[model samples]
Target: MSPDIVTDPSRAKRLKAATHAAHDRLDKSIMRLEPFSSIDRYALFLAVQHGFHQDVDALYDDPALDGLLPDLKHRRRLDKIAQDLADLGRTAPAAGSKPVLAGDLPTALGWLYVAEGSNLGAAFLLKEAGKLGLSEDCGARHLAGSPEGRGLHWRIFTTALDAVPLTQEEEARVIAGARAAFMRVQFLADAVFIPSPSD
Candidate 1:
């Protein structure tokens, strides 16, 4: 089943923006990966966006169905995601020159996956918080305040996730588990760093 079916369109749109922000951040993270630099940041960004669709597919067990993996294992998919990102960071030059960037498209995407994934995961966390009749403010505050070292924009994005609806304390427990699982996945994805090789 396609993963797009389950992903909220608005969420996907936000993910796209987040992906663009990552590309811009990469421009600063590594000067060599600039949009006009030898590297094609725009193409790389599109590739990373494509990776999101791939993630959605991985998330779904069937059309409109959740992933096959248990909620606790949701982060497990980060392994493949990191790999895909590493591939994205590298792009071939128009003249067929050697790959300009130290890493590939997947690596660039990896950076983005870390940011946007957290926001999405926070959404689930908020849902859980709502279940307990507790305002997601506690968790949302963490995200808003960038408690986990996330950026200001990301913190705000996480707070946005808290707006969703979820009921029942038991459901909140499940969502919390999902949030924890998401953090694990984000950590794994963030750990994949491909340094530039020495000349």
Candidate 2:
């Protein structure tokens, strides 16, 4: 996890602990791809973001979820990612088989947790994008910081996430969903950023 992220003693902390290993693996995999190596490489990275966000796009607007996380609607970044892709002169790849979380709000929250938590690390990513001549208004819109800023934005999100009541079974499913979300990104990263033979 980014040192900037503070996971309090709540469901968010539990998730941070449970998903730590998977999260580390995903980060290492992405770093190995070196998505910041160049503008082209970053475009491939955006494609991966586009694909993963596209999979979870519906969750942002889900009425049930919005009731729990009131700021949910403004958090959707798929369109921003699409804009980034367009700025780079690339189109979104065809969707893959998305994770099946429909009608399963607990599981869906887990997936949403992984997606939203990523923004915490976007501060570093946004700087790297700058090296490639991409800014919030240009090719890196998806990585732009929220007006509330990263730390406060994340705190607000995790606060709401921790407040949602869950049965024991649902809590277990939430952990599983978060892990699955990480694995899904790993799969997409592999597909979108094919490694050279030497890698």
Candidate 3:
């Protein structure tokens, strides 16, 4: 099932609209860092991924979220990301402060939405990793396509996400959580992708 096939009035659509600006800004910021310019730069990019995934690692196991999304546990990529870091001989960076969603299920869903949505783009990143001589079994495991494939995986998630019941206030929190998720990635990217003194 392609995501395009799932076009319905949905929380997924709403969240996408709400976070568009933040998402675009983060994309530009990451591109500015030129993460794919070299193996070293790609390693830094992996570190940023590790940091962000670590922040939301626990949410994959949240009972409430699991009930909402099918096979929620399988959606986690933190372990894959950690392995990718190790494959590059880089230690996984410590997770930053806890996510703003904390124990809030609605907000956590929002964060998960952003995290899961990123997988769709990972296909392209995985190609870039190929230029660095990294493959799914090597230094790019975290970016590999799921067995179900990216489009189907995303469609399944958004279908689940759009169906989750929330009040108007909770919906607002979901948007806030998504924006915060983007901000967190931007922060991590900035911290890890710092230019050398010669640059």
Candidate 4:
């Protein structure tokens, strides 16, 4: 094992490192969607977000995770997404398939990492949403930055994730789960009407 994994193996750090390719897939996928071009596409973006969150919403209730990050439930954004859709005078759009997650704890944390880590990206997305005439109080509530901010919240989650012990094989599962989570989001991005701005 590398000294880093042996001495201070942070799941968060490792997840970020190991899942770079999957993470890039999600990034490239989102960029193909020019959500800022119009309000409709932006709303569709919100629906995509809702769909992804809804599928994995139950993870927060997992007893094993609760023992570690009891406040895991607090990170749910389905209700917020619903509220944003309501603000737009729309309802939840149908999503694609449910995400296939790992049933084990260490593996599940990998999924959670992808889910919770998304808020950090939302800090930037929220700004882009603003350019489309949306705001936290209205159609972009789900994209709004948290009062506590993404950095602090992510730190809390990563700290909890690293605190858990895992075998190297288990760590492999966790990394795979994170990659799967990203792949699921990329799949969701496919069903939408991805648009581009007129240059």
Candidate 5:
């Protein structure tokens, strides 16, 4: 079944609930790939991140979604990512180009769900970075938890997401957006680096 079908069992318009379920269902295999296990792997991860956000951050300018999630601009990490790549002697690759957003707010929020939720995963990834001697002050800014704190910031987004009243159809688009966001990350990951059979 398509991963987005996780949303099929969901009837509520609560974007948080639906999106969270989508992440849980779809990201397990991607997460298992352990993109931060080494500096090369980590750098590739950073490049793809830079590419994805550089592609999607324009969604922040969408007045419809911006009105709902104004702090969207404040959440950008492309600059941090570019610096991290530079520290690693890498450049923002051509792969860092724009991603497709389907041109609407709910779709943007679906993408936002993927982006913000990634921040919540930082506490774990930060430790992996530590294993490679990377830190918030040095080569791993993206894995550094949100400046405000991870859990609290995630709660703020989820609260806003759940509070928005979506139509049944809008909720579906949101789910589709979240799924697309995951696929983009996975696609870029494959573009930049993929573990060999022995790994």
Candidate 6:
């Protein structure tokens, strides 16, 4: 069964703070890491916003670096990553065991985890793990999610089931964190839609 997210208040507060801090830090760091071109910035934003979608693709598209990740090589890597994620999503439960949720992963704040196509599963997985206090192979690595390339950084928790088999405590934290991150991404999307006076 899914953990109830509403009753507890503390988890709600902590997740809000953590996600906001993450969003803010990502924004500032991206600006420092890339040129001011619109495409560069947007590419970076997508890495953060649609993290589960095209991080590897964006990295593969980089050109100025010269042989760093040539076009053909980049495409191949992205294709492989996508295929792996898809395989993970379609994997069946072990014999005599049933799925914990209807889908491979639960939808959080209307954002379904997109495996085999993006790094979103990694993001959600990281967040969920934090709530459960589990350890991960990557040990909270950032999973890139940036325009320049895929990168890893230490995150809070690990383990895919950390988000799953959640306790009442963990559930509330996941919901709050998911909601806040969702709102932040939505705001970023809306900002992209706004027309400037120069336009």
Alpha-carbon RMSD to native, per candidate: 17.7, 5.9, 5.2, 4.4, 6.0, 19.7
- What is each predicted model's overall lDDT from 0 to 1? 0.34, 0.88, 0.86, 0.79, 0.73, 0.34
Candidate 6 structure quality by residue, lDDT tens digits, 124-168: 544543453322333223332434433221121221213334455
Q: Candidate 2: where are CA atoms >4 Å away?
A: 1-9, 195-199
Q: What are the models' TM-scores?
A: 0.23, 0.91, 0.91, 0.87, 0.80, 0.26
Question: Any residue pairs clashing in model 5, and if so which?
Answer: 51-96, 55-98
Q: Regarding TM-score, does 5 or 6 come out ahead?
A: 5
User: lDDT tens digits, residues 70-162, model 2?
Assistant: 689999999999999999899877777764555799889889999999998999999999998889999999898889799999999998998
- TM-score of model number 6: 0.26
What is the C-alpha local distance difference test score of candidate 1?
0.34
Top candidate by lDDT: 2
Which parts of model 6 are misplaced by more than 4 Å? 1-6, 9-12, 34-166, 172-199
- How should the candidates be ordered by lDDT, best one leading? 2, 3, 4, 5, 6, 1
Cα-based RMSD of candidate 6: 19.7
Pairs clashing within candidate 2: none
| Best-to-worst TM-score order | 2, 3, 4, 5, 6, 1
Better of 1 and 6 by TM-score: 6
Residue 75 accuracy (lDDT) in model 2: 95
Q: Mind giving the per-residue lDDT tens digits that candidate 5 earns over 39-144? A: 8878877877887887777776666666666486787787888888888888877644556563776778788888888888878878888898888988887777
Q: Who is ahead in TM-score, 1 or 5?
A: 5
TM-score of 5: 0.80
Q: How many residue pairs collide in each prediction?
A: 16, 0, 0, 0, 2, 7
lDDT of 1 at 157: 39
Compare candidates 4 and 6 on TM-score and give the better one. 4
> Ten-residue segment with the worst summed lDDT in candidate 2?
1-10
lDDT of 2: 0.88
